[model samples]
Target chain A: MDTAGATRILAVVTPDSGLVGPGGAPVFMAHSQEEQERLALLLARIMGGVPHDLENGVYIVVKHS
Target chain B: MQNHVLTILLGVVAGTLARLVMLRSDYRHYPSYPHGFVTHISLGFIAALVGAVAVPALAKPDYVAATFLILAAQQFREIRNMERETLARIEQTKLVQRGSDYIEGIAGVFEARNYLVIITALATSGANHLWGWPVALGVAVISLVISHLLMQGECVGDIADVVPGKVHFDRSLLMVGDVVIMNVGLPAFREKVLEEGRGVVLKPRDDDARLTLDSIGQRQAILHDISVILGTKIDEKEMEFMPLAKKNADTGEIGIFLLPNEPDLECLVEIIKKVPVIESSKARPLSSYYGRRAAD
Candidate 1:
């Protein structure tokens, strides 16, 4: 299967902070750090790997060659 | 002092009989679990009471004292059995995740300490004739409180370990994923993409297809889509699910990703069997993998 066009997106959602993306996407709700880590890991394993460096509690998508 | 001895002895007998009855009646319900030393302590109290009342020799204060010792010994035996049962259950319900280890450890420590406390209380109660009743009662109450605290600590620690730490998916998650994959993704893939031989891979409005592929790649895309919809993490590194495993696309070598207890693979095979070309290959045994490690 050609996966070259696939993009990786990481979004951290917690109870305190709703959803935060890597690129300063508006936070949806407040969440805890634990919740954020849980969401991030869930996203990463689901996608098989994290494509981009997630910082400030947001998911980043990476394009494959 | 003699009357007090008789009262304490009667309490012991009552407690012991009650314990025996409790164990006999309820042991089956928790065949895999243990009720702990408290049950045995109760039984000791019952047995002492029975000894004091029913046995003529035990009517005297000295005999009452002897009865308490005998009952305490019996309680110790029951406690030992309870520990064995608890350990067996722990082994049976082995946690397969990283953070769950702390839970098992904490449970072990609490159980061991609780047993020690019960034993100490029983010994103290049996050894002292003048103030055995009050001392035994006090010890029992204190021990129960400590046990409760230990249980509370274990619960809090387990929650902490599970909530904030890295999510490690285990067999239960795989089973859940298998259900979701079969129910949602399988039908969607079969009707929209496989049967039609082409379909647009939907992307979130902001995210591009290229970036998705780079992060998760092709094989992983299926997993990602499934996870996105189902909302769970795959933590078991050894776990894998393959939809097709006929032969290597390039070298024609047989691929083996399906492991023991991989129900997802079975579901995929069932789907593939509907296709004429794919069904021609020999079917693999899947049920043989079930409970492969259960005894261990």
Candidate 2:
């Protein structure tokens, strides 16, 4: 209902170890080409959110209303 | 009858002057050419002429004649539509486009200004008829000042704090303050952003300010103004490098990360301050009781 706050981050995944994706908006940091491809496949499976591979070596998953 | 003629002429002169005063081409470069400027001035002159004649026509007991003023007012709305269409068409060619919201706000202002000119002309001319040239001149001065004041509107910095921040990365994510702008996939682009980009944090002073800043249109206006002044690093293919404003979900502070042609942080800050708050995005919750409680 609140359009202003409509965009919510589903997770933040990172390439760094011990870092976790926050449940809501997943942010993925792909460290290697293999990891990047693997993460891309996993992101493709998620139905509720959209994963964007920002050309800057990171993947961000965002959810829309 | 002669006095009526004199009064109508006085109104036309005063109204024409008022219209001429308000018409200008500034940062937006709208009415960019002499032809556009002349067209607006001519329309303004007609609006003023119509407004001035209304009073005299009514006084002569020609109520039917005064109805023409209403018709003239309707034409001003067409002016608004024309401006909106022209700006909308022109916007497509812009590198950093002024979003529809900003364009609408500008079109609305241009339309309203014609009405102001009408009022100024009507009042001055009416005074001239009732009193004399001396009193009408005084009335004209007062109305012009009032018009000038009414024309002044709020800018971004009036309701928020804009301060230059650093454009650095938290790993691969680009950020300004706590707001994560976007994730940069290319290290080279990231390095370029770090080298040339500037960051500014906009902290809203209150609830209304927060809401206003939240409007997408207002943010776009800020970006457009910055691009107009400093030039943007936006290439047609490089959408990632486009200037972006992201809000800190927790703090409500908005951060702008831009790679400008001129990276003078202080000048960037000044330009941000001067950027007009889009009219549609302007919020005034303090005027309402419920909004007041939310502010607290």
Candidate 3:
């Protein structure tokens, strides 16, 4: 009955930085704080991922493992 | 001979009655089924039997009977272990789990209650042997009250102030009052939560309360209690809809957001107030003088 999804750091997206998988699934970087949030929200919807705001310019989207 | 028999009978009946009166299946539902009840009651009867016989056995110089009490104590400890295992197993299937601390607390209570039954029975029998039935009855009543007091523990209201809060969203972020729970990507899910969700703010009264509420286990217990009483909107597959309690780093206030079936704000507040503070999570750093000075 655990409510939390078993999630982990899948990818990290920052304002100026991004990461990529061996499969070339790029973690898209955002230009601004607002853009980061907006992209996070959009990517979350498309990817069915959980968007977590680091409260900085960075946002991480995690998917259920 | 008649006095000896009456003493044991009075003690056993008193002990059994004490166990029955104290046994309650509350929101946590420890003794959930009929079998659970049967197991506890059977154990209570055995505890009473052992307690009732101890005094007479000693008087008869039958030292062997005294060893039975030790054996019963071991049995009760095993009961505690059994309870913990059963609850941990059941917890796996719960939507809002009773954390390990809460489970341990409950198992400990069950074990302690059995010991209390033994004490009540033995004391009642001893009183009967010394001063007859009238004094035994008085002792029984006193034991009942003692057991009642022992069972009563501190509730969330004792430590915090529960007030109704609002569940809202600013863009993708889901905010319970002023606290940001998390960023929601799906507009549809965000819309659904905003439409159906309820929120509560737990304001800690002091440092101790803040520390207690800060425990992840205590927060989970609050969520579990609210979810159990009001019925959660989400099922096992829908983890996104599950209730969450988040603490504001600056204010030390906790915001709880959940999509409940009832959605009655007043009822939710009352349930939060009544949630028992888990014994293991209770912290009293403020009690020591050095802790007070360190706060500066």
Best by lDDT: 3
CAPRI classification of candidate 2: incorrect
Best by DockQ: 3
Per-chain TM-score of candidate 3, chain B: 0.96
The two-chain DockQ for each candidate, comma-separated, is 0.02, 0.10, 0.18
Who is ahead in lDDT, 2 or 3?
Answer: 3
Tens digit of per-residue lDDT, candidate 2, span B1-296: 78878787877787778777787788767778799889988988898888888888877879888886788688899988998999899887887889999999989988888898889889988898788879988988888888878888998899899998878888778899888998765455677989999999999998889989999899998998889889887665335577888999777899998899999999999999988888899888888998898777
| Model 3: lDDT to the true structure | 0.83
TM-scores for candidates 1 onward, in order:
0.26, 0.82, 0.85
What ordering of candidates by lDDT runs from best to worst? Answer: 3, 2, 1
- List chain B TM-scores, each candidate: 0.29, 0.96, 0.96
RMSD of each: 21.9, 6.4, 4.9
lDDT of 2 at B280: 90
Q: Can you tell me which runs of candidate 1 are displaced by over 4 Å? A: A1-65, B6-147, B150-296
Model 3 stretches astray by more than 4 angstroms:
A1-6, A9-61
